[model samples]
Target: MANITLFAQAIGRLPKECIRKIIREEKTDKHSKGYDTWSQFISMMFCQFSGCDSVRDISNGLNSANGNLNHLGICRAPSKSTVAYQNAKRDSGVFRRIFYALLAHFGQQAVWQRTRYRFKMPIKLLDSSTITLTMSLYEWAHYTTRKGGGEDAYIA
Candidate 1:
């Protein structure tokens, strides 16, 4: 049996027919180009699953998996520039529709449905970047020992 990576197995289960239907309806690939909407979707999904920090990481990560990309349905991995351009130019609504379509296909409710309570104050997010910098170059940086808050509770 051929070995399939967990990422491939996970993405393989997505409703490709539903995705294609939405893509056709949206006309996301109206322009003639090698880098199409499907490729862009796969690239973005890879970025999310792999915790990629940037387009370069996504491109390099996919390129490194050259032999295995066929399982993801693309003929080849996209370049950094292609991925970046698609990310900037593509209509975001297409992706949003795809997300909703998949959620419905899997019989799952919208993400917002899981939140049972609303906070009086707006939520703020902090990014603790995965990238490391030299302490000498970034003297203002400080590390926090706080643990991530548990679910169903708010942290002040």
Candidate 2:
């Protein structure tokens, strides 16, 4: 159907680079360099929201686009274990920056037409509600080495 094709086209379109430019990454201190370079991080995340559940899935099956992403200068499509290792060791705040970029992109996509009908109250999630389980919470829960590990009350 035409509608299906339009939706598919939207999915196939690359996210605007403006979204990447908007997120403000914190300046790293001289002593510490971040792992999983920015481009690698972005590629992994792009694959993530596109519904790739695992790093192996990133370049495998329907959502696979490792080659495509590589062509754009993002880091190499990593092995599953590599993705897991980097994710566990990296600063989570860095990942949050990607999320912020996504929110900005979504905001830009919202159209406010003059002839639109009155907007109704939007829905919201409760503070304690379970959100998406996209995190590697095992690290947070075990706290094998990080301070305050095993804190069940922590937010994802």
Predicted model with the maximum TM-score: 1
Residue 61 lDDT in candidate 2? 31
What stretches of model 1 exceed 4 Å from their correct place?
108-156
Quick one: best lDDT, which candidate? 1
* Local accuracy of candidate 1 as per-residue lDDT tens digits, 1-156: 988877898788898999999999999999938788888998988898899999999999999999888878888989888998889889999999999888787666445456578899898765443444455555544343332222233343
Residue-pair clashes per prediction, in order, are 0, 0
User: TM-scores across all candidates?
Assistant: 0.68, 0.42
- What's every prediction's RMSD, in angstroms? 11.5, 14.7
Query: How displaced is residue 26 in candidate 2, in Å?
Result: 2.3
Question: How many steric overlaps does candidate 2 have?
Answer: 0
lDDT for model 1 comes to: 0.82
lDDT of each: 0.82, 0.50
